[model samples]
Target: MQEAAGAAGEISEFAGPSEEEELQRQARAVAQPDETEALNWTMKKFRFPLERLLNYRRSRLAGEQARLEKLLAEQAGLEQRRAALEREERMVNESLRRLPVISSEQLAAIASFRRFAASEAVRLAAEIHAAAGRVAAQRDAVLSARREVEVLEKLRERRLHDWRREVDQETERQTAELVVARWALSRESG
Candidate 1:
């Protein structure tokens, strides 16, 4: 009976070391940093502020996009008007070309017709010119709005990148601190 008890004690001591070794391995595994910690740090550092900025930028972009769309629509309308005016001008020129050569009496009547046609042509030309101006103005407005949105987007991207970099740097620092703490704890335990 005494021999059996002694043998049991020896086995228990051997088991203890193995149990301790397994515990140490588990501790080492737990001490290793995970990607989740880095992601958490980034979110904590940047998400709130970035969200605020993003909201403001989104609102501004929405407004600008709407304005640009409206301007483009106006430009399309103006272009259609200008095209119609050009077609009318072409038809008028063709009619003038096809008209018969006139005698003196016919000349007076033809002169009055020519004068009236010239006045109509001038009026159509003015309308076309005005439509062209409006189209150009609307196009420029849309372009300007687009440029503004692009600039804001670039700024937002830069801000997000800066925030991400800061979070990454902080995560690296925390990881180093965690490693040192784990090393000290292990040494103390040993």
Candidate 2:
């Protein structure tokens, strides 16, 4: 009976690893991080280098647009004034036609007023033409500024995409490492 009891104790002792020992081994493996994690450390944060330039370009575009609007407003005011002058001139002509007994002095005065109105109309038309040219030039400036900003933004987007791809690769690599580590552990225990 004593020899059988001793043999049973020897068999229990030779039983591979206890449940508690297996749990402890797993804990130790978790504590000892793999070399891959130590090497990778952390990823670089994304940053746009031309952010300030982009902002400046947007602001320049806004300024150019504002100048165009101001020019348009000035041209509109000039047109309105010209329309008022035309209406006044028409009223004057109507009055002259309705007058049946106008003196020579009155006729000369009306002729002088008509000459002044004609000169003023010519000056205003020239100013409107100049304003139109300025507005067209400002529109071109705005378009150029917008294009510059768009180029910078596209570059930024491409850089961001590359950074994301790198991050995803790193994540996949770390996941692969973890899987490999788990597989090694399973082999060792099995």
Candidate 3:
């Protein structure tokens, strides 16, 4: 937040007052969901130089999160596949155990089926490992993007807070000036 403020302040050294209508409009825009915090009567236009960057970071965060979800879905698919493979392997083994080894041909076929099931189990394990790695990578990306968005949001809130403070000070100064002017008029009339 401080970084954002410094960047904005450096970009525009010549600070000036905004029009009343513009200030009121921005104040109204900020009022939504924060009626209590925004009850400062008015607020100045809180412009941040890094608004575009903040928006881009937010978008990137969404994209990263989506990718993480996709990776998780893939992992779930791999788990389902492994479970199905285990069921098939168990069914084949049970059938073989129940069947008598009467013919050499039958024994050879059973051995081949067992080998095939083992190979399939190995392949599935490899796929699961790969999916886990991808999911971990995507999760890291999502976390980094989330942090970026958080920082930007905090900066925006800080800028708004500062703007409200400025508006309050300005309002106070104007009120004092009015009071002094009225006193002078009364003195002159008397």
lDDT of 1 at 144: 71
lDDT, each prediction: 0.68, 0.85, 0.79
Question: How does residue 84 of candidate 2 score in lDDT?
Answer: 92
lDDT of 2 at 14: 97
Question: Against the true structure, candidate 2 has what lDDT?
Answer: 0.85
Model 1 off-target regions past 4 Å? 1-42, 45-116
Looking at model 2, residue 140 earns an lDDT score of 88
lDDT of residue 3 for candidate 1: 100
Could you tell me how far off, in angstroms, the CA of residue 74 lies in candidate 3 after the best superposition?
0.8
**Local error of candidate 3 at 26, Å?**
30
Q: List the residue pairs that clash in candidate 3.
A: none
Ranking of all predicted structures according to lDDT, beginning with the best and ending with the worst: 2, 3, 1
For every model shown, the clashing-pair count is: 0, 0, 0
Clashing pairs in 2: none
lDDT of 1 by residue, 21-135 (tens): 7766655654764788556655464444455655666676677667657666755665576566567657756776887864687568657766866776677567657766766
Give the per-residue lDDT of model 3 (tens digit) for 116-163: 888988998999999999999998899999998999899898988888
